[model samples]
Target: MNSELEALNSLIMTEADGLLYEKGLIRKLEKYGDVFISGSYFLQLMTWRDLDIYLASDKMNEETFFELGKEVSLCIKPAKMNYRNEFIGHTEHLPKGYYWGCYADFNTNAWKVDVWAISSKEFEQKQQEIEKLKFQINVVQRMAILKLKNSVYNHPLYRKKFFSVDIYNAVIEDNVNSEEKFKYWLQIKRGLSLN
Candidate 1:
């Protein structure tokens, strides 16, 4: 088996404090760093040897660190600014990326008040939705939207690292048009909200 899968299997069998992070999990987290980081500003961890040399750390496992070459280091928050959303030599920024967003507050005055992260793709899709609302005709109200630019988004199917029931309801009851209640934030910003 691949090293990542083997590590996960071992974790499952050994009653380790954490589960192993797979490549798919890595991809998904990188895809949605904004959502995950917002929930885990301090979730990153590393290991040290008896000589105090820094060994590999599990970004996903809050507890232990697998040594280098044993398993891939768990990318704690893949989409963090320092990694993908980073600057090149302190000058140009990486191309603008998106994070997953949900309606935290429906009012423009409170639009940016709520804080969170989202995947870059979901971030763009939500952008399209808000841009849709920005040009809408009367009868539909556009609430001020705050973009979640860094973490992995979660509800149920999402890794569920940053699940928020309240955000789920806001997206469903607001202006979004998505049939799936899972994409709650997108629905609100899109003006297709069920509410």
Candidate 2:
């Protein structure tokens, strides 16, 4: 791992720890269901202050989920919280569950926390995908991913025109090793031109 990437990841992890444990976010979440941290944080490829948390429950209803949201609001005092009931109206490329998109200031940094309430089955399915990526990622690919992620973290097209999965695929599957190569890959594969 690049020394710079390692240091940046460490700083982000420390902030994440403060948010999860010190802020009692995880404790509050566990009261509702089994909480599983995922995404960049779990993959240890964090380039920004974002957290993906999933609450697995065999039985979860809207009322209970709202109650959970209420508790989360009181705990985190988020700047804004967006709710999505995907279970009722599932969206493409999204899980079928309740979601809370929490935007908050933690440790003097703005953080985006995605909290999902899904069935254990759904959680398991997602975990399988993450594990596959985890297994396929070698040190070289990890560094490539980290570099590409860092390069695009603040780009105009970061999450709007492209996403982390595209970066991962470019590096892991298409062998994209630099920002220049990633730009070309995006243009060829997704017809997206950054410039």
Best by lDDT: 2
Q: What TM-score does structure 2 among the candidates reach?
A: 0.94
Please give the lDDT score for candidate 2.
0.92
User: lDDT tens string, model 2, 1-195?
Assistant: 499998999899999999999989999999988898998988999999999999998789999989999999998889999999997777787899999999999878999999999999999988888888888899999999999999889998888889999998999898999999999999999999999
Q: In model 2, what is the error at residue 38, expressed in angstroms?
A: 0.5
Candidate that scores best on TM-score:
2
- Worst lDDT 10-window in candidate 1: 44-53
Clashes of each: 30, 0
Per-residue lDDT over 17-74 for candidate 1, one digit per residue giving the tens place of the 0 to 100 score: 1211332323433332332222111111111000001111123221221121122223
RMSD (Å) per prediction: 18.7, 1.4
Error of 1 at 109 (Å): 11
lDDT scores for all predictions? 0.26, 0.92
